[model samples]
Target: MAKTFAIVVGESSGDQLGAPLIKELKKRYPDAKFIGIGGEKMIAEGFESLFDMERLSVMGLFEVLSRLPELLKIRKTLKNHFLQNPPDVYIGIDAPDFNLPLARMLKAHGIKTMHYVCPSVWAWREKRVEKIKKSVDSMLCLLPFEVEFCQKHQLNATFVGHTLADKIPLEKQTLQAREKLKLNVDAPVLCMMPGSRQSEIKRMAPLFIQSVNKIAQSIENLFVLIPVSSEKREKQLQEYLVEASFKYQIIKQDSISALSAANVALITSGTAALEAMLCKTPMVVSYKANALTYKIISKMLTIDYVSLPNIIANREIIKELLQDDATEQNIVNAVLILMGKNEQLRQIELFTQMHRSLIAQADIQAVNAIDSLLLSK
Candidate 1:
């Protein structure tokens, strides 16, 4: 009989992680059947999606609460489906809020469960490590530090390296990327990534737009590039950009190209920071959540930095302007500092070193870890 695998991924970032794993898993078991929740990438890899991945793409505490009923219903449906007709193994890719509880329930019924990305327990919610131990059979981690943390808690974990590192080249081509985007090579280009999610864009887009207007006054012939995740988000950003007085371009769903071509980036903190790092773009990372959500997260967070570049480097390699501090003036000032050649070169050198540290064959490593769990069962 062919092996059956069920995988659930939450958002675009999760979709990117799942697609490569699905392809590699298919190579191992050509007759394997994959089913669960995913986006375009996993669907292209021949994985059957049970529900639309957008349902679980919500972020922040307040955002999740607003969508709780629908999210719970989707989770309940997946839980019941897997319980009735269990796959050989089930993989939950990120979205710990929705996936962890579902994984725990499936594990209770003797179903093999794996969580692709470990939650930021190391950053906050230290108590979650205990719950993760109960839920996950194996935790496939992207960062090297995560392995020791998971092992110390007695959860079966493996460091699979980061897919971004494997995919991004050691040397990024700025001029070529600019040429591809039809941008002037000499002009100062700013990549403004509000974020991938609607909630994030809603909160950060106006802030970023205002900041761009401020920066444009100082830097002449500035070209701003904003990468929207979808047509919906592009429209949303366009609505916000109506008040701006600056030269800007909106690129649909091509964040990498935007990041690669930019001189500096004013990015909302998250996966975009990591992408900017890989592209060797000097960036001022900023984020703002709903008032209540920021308050709750502020108390819970154990770490000093939010951006991936600073978090991975374990220091303040890049400036982070968060919540009230993420004002238009602060953003403009940070971008001005980043415009200097010495500052840009320093950040690029650090980015190169960070990229080298993360380059492991992630797909193969993830497959090996998943296969080990299946064999043990």
Candidate 2:
């Protein structure tokens, strides 16, 4: 008989990590029975899910609070089910809010628990380490900087190379990507990534639309491209665009085109910005959050910069306009600057440097790292 593992992943990002991790775990224990709460990718990888992942994808303290009763019901059900018949291991992927407490309950019931992707405890509340110690048997981190903190608390942690380091293809040729997407070779392209979440789309879409209008007022023959995740999200975004009265072309599912087809991008600060950087495009980063959440989180953030390019570079290479700073005027100014002499060259130069730094290993490396960690204990 083979050992069984129950894995719960929180959102799209967690889903991304879970898929590759599943493949690696399968290699380690060929006959392992894997089941969990995850999105489409895990299901495709032969994992049985307890529920659709969107249930756990809720964001912000207030948002989670509003869904408290229903969430508690789900958690209680999971606790009872796992307690009755525990798996050999329980792996929680990146939905710390949902995963942490569940891990605690299951761990207390004698199931071995592991958390993949440390929450930004190093960036914001160092106190979270104590909570993490009680919940997980081990912590798996993607960044090199995070291990010390995990070790300080005496929790087992491993620095697995980032999934992006493996997933982002090296051959994203600017002209080739543009030609393949049927974008004009001569026109300056602008990629707009509003966000992946409903809260983000609701909060940032209006400002993003207004910024687009401001940029369009000055530039002629500008090609604006937006990549939406799904048909439902695409419809919701189109409604927002229509309501805001911003005119733009929508790309069905080609996010790579949004990166490679662009002269520059005005993106929300997250994975999309990193992807754009990997594609070697110049960009300005922006973000906004709920007023109360922003006020609380602002004081907690220790990093001087919010954008990934700036964080990775340890300095501001690409411009970042956050919250009140992310106005139409500033966004337009940043875009205009990128369009000016040698600005694109400078941005691409920095982007290429960052890409080289991230090229240490790919997905297989991350898989190997996880397998090694599991075997170490």
Q: lDDT (0-100) at residue 216 of candidate 1?
A: 93
Structure candidate 1, residue pairs in collision: none
Candidate 2 structure quality by residue, lDDT tens digits, 221-271: 777889876576687788778744344678865676778878888888877
Candidate 2: worst 10 consecutive residues by lDDT? 360-369
Q: Distance (Å) between predicted and true CA of 325, model 1?
A: 0.4
TM-score of 1: 0.97
lDDT over C-alpha atoms for residue 323 of model 1 = 88
The CA lDDT of each predicted structure is 0.90, 0.79
Task: List TM-score per model, in order.
Answer: 0.97, 0.90
Off by over 4 Å in 1: none
- Candidate 2's C-alpha runs over 4 A off are 170-172, 243-247, 252-254, 360-362, 369-377
> How would you encode candidate 1's per-residue C-alpha lDDT over 46-118 as one tens digit per residue?
9899998877889988789899999999999999999998999989999998899999999999999999988
